[model samples]
Target chain A: MAHITVTVDGTSYKGEVEPRKLLVHWLREDIGRVGTVVGCDTSNCGACTVLLNGRSVKSCSVLAVQADGSEVTTIQGLSDGNEWHPVQTAFKECHGLQCGYCTPGMVMATVDLLSENPTPSEQEIREGLEGNLCRCTGYHNIVKSVSYAADLMSAGPTKGAK
Target chain B: MIPVEFDYVKVTTIDQAIAALKAGGEDSKIISGGQSLVPVLRLRMAEPSVLVDCGAIDEMLGVREDGGSITIGAATTHHAVMSNPLVQKHALLLAQATATVADPAIRHRGTTGGALAHADPAGDVPAAALALDASFTIAGPGGRRTVAAKDFFLDYFTTAVGPDEILVSFSIPKCDWGSHYAKFNRTAQAWAIVGVAAVVNVEGGVIKEARIGLTNMAPTAVRASTVEAALVGASSAADITAAAMHAADGTRATSDLHAKADYREHLARVITARAVRAASGI
Candidate 1:
């Protein structure tokens, strides 16, 4: 076992984890951030998405040890704790999610996307969130949510925080 | 599934990383970015005794233009390649193909050297490297040496890089060549069923020079010699398309559920033509 410290959700965490423990397992097991789901242990599915150093990455594919000195933001980290992030708000208003299994990852990936492109075109939205998969909604609603989030984010801080 | 337990050493320097690889020897795996190798490990397709992490080697992470060539560090991410102006100015074919690689997340983490070293037959980088005539700079205890991209790839998932040697960087000569990449993929993030990269130089309405590299049509990324030969004097779209029909002439392709061999061959021909037309501007 190796002892490592990770900064997750803006909080410092110290734990003793095995060398092979994946970041997804660490997120759920050690950190108790169960909102992050691991749809496919392999990378083909993007269900276990998270923001590492301000970029989205499939958490399951990364070993916990690899994130030793990195900052990770899971789905649980999105809001300022009072409300949903812009992506979550847009996802809800646009009816972008159903069953909600892939929502957390979709929301996180969308947050990363919209921050990079505040006013993404419809096609650009689709292309930006291509790494994320939302089978429950057939991606129609998810794309809508991303588009809505882009609009809301373009409107500035008012729409997202509320 | 979780991977088997193994010693993991995240080295912070290129020399340290290379030393770890040397100590671990043949059973060691040098991992950077881990976009491609991680999945393989989770699936248990490969079992290495040690993983020498090269992600922390900051020296291997950036792009710059020196003299007449654009040099990109081995650890530089695909996103960096796409965003860097030096790469855009000198190797636009590389930039465009880098954009088409796996999607945003993978692009954010995947490294240029890792992709080239993986050398998947369906990958876009090898073909792009071939099109640009890039050279790889590898380092080991013996110091540094450069190998032509054509000779760098030995076979499927294999390269001239030995276990002890680290792929330090890649250097691509700057050119005024017109370049383009055309790929046929099943989805937004799926591997290319077939991809083509073309670089052309047209002089006075006739073809002065042309180079074509094909993906998913052979064991390794191979050049379309027949197409190159046939398009030498032909300046018309129809003639180039006819020449591109021979794109898959020299290789054996494996068929899978995504696409059959015959269909892939057809895609190679069609994509090659489109790439040539766009690149050669005819």
Candidate 2:
């Protein structure tokens, strides 16, 4: 086993892990960040998406050793300890999820999309989140949530809606 | 879902990676972005005993412009290539096709070299690279060498890159060609059933030159040289449409659940016409 040091959600972790340990497993098993779910072990489903150095990546497709010395932010770390991030609030208010299985990955992917294109058209939002799939909701409400999140984020540093 | 047990070593230099490959022998597979290899490992399609991680190799990263050509490092992420000014200005086809790859998250992790080395006929980048006449530079124990992109892809899930060799970079000449990529997929993220990459150089209302590359219509990404030959000196959209009918002239397309060979041929012609029209700015 090789030792790897990584900073997840703002906490630095050092552990001896096997080479084959996937990042999604490492996040849930080793670091106790169960918020990042693995809907499909194949890269097709994006339920395990997270931010690696501020860019979204499917954690299920990434090995823990590959993330060595990198900073990873999962759905659990999106907000300051107390309140939900704007994207999170937007999802809740807009009813963006039904089963919530794909929520964490979808929300994280949106954080990436909005940061890249602060004001995207509905088509652009749909295209941006194409990698993340949802069986419930048919993506209509999820698109609305992203639109709402964009508006909330555009309103400046106010805390997300309650 | 979990990959079988394997030994892993992360390397910081080209030589170190080469040495690791040599020591680990044939069972060792090089992992750059892990966007492709990891999935295969998870599915148990490959059982490599060791994985040499080359993600930290700084030498094999970024884009460099030299005189009339740009050399993209093998490890350069798709996101980096998509956003690079040099690629946008000179190789816009690459940038345009890259934007359509997997998605933002996969783009963040997949590398140009990895995609080319994977050599999947359904991938968009290989056809784009072929239309641009890109050259791949490789390094192995015997030293370094270069191979034309046309000769790089040997078969399905195979490449000219030997197990002991690493694809170092890809270089393409600067040209005044306007290009377009036309891809057809059932879903937003599905692989192309049949795709076409077209590059056109027009002067004085006549086609000065044209290069057409067809993807997933053959065992390897093959050039629509017949269509290209028929398009030279042609000006009208009708002329382009006529020439594009030959898009599948020499191809050996297959019949699959996604699309039948005949349907793929029909789509090839239609998409080639569309790509050529957009590329010629007509």
Backbone atom clashes (below 3 Å) for every candidate? 0, 0
What digit string (tens of lDDT, one per residue) describes model 1 on residues B115-182?
Answer: 99888888889998988889999988888899998899888888888888888889899967888999
Which RMSD values do the candidates have, in order? Answer: 1.4, 0.9
DockQ, every prediction: 0.82, 0.89
Candidate 2 lDDT over residue span B1-282, tens digit each: 789999999999999999999999889999999899999999998899899988778878999997889999989999999999999999999988888888889999999878988889999999999999999999999999999988998898788899999998999898668899999999978899998999999998899899988999998898999999999988999999999999999899999999899999999999999999999986
- Give the share of true interchain contacts found in each model: 0.83, 0.88
Evaluate residue A29 in candidate 2 and report its C-alpha lDDT on the 0 to 100 scale: 98
User: Each candidate: what lDDT?
Assistant: 0.87, 0.92
Which run of 10 residues does model 2 chain B get worst, by summed lDDT? Answer: B169-178
Candidate 2 at A75: error in angstroms? 0.6
- TM-scores, each model vs. reference: 0.97, 0.99
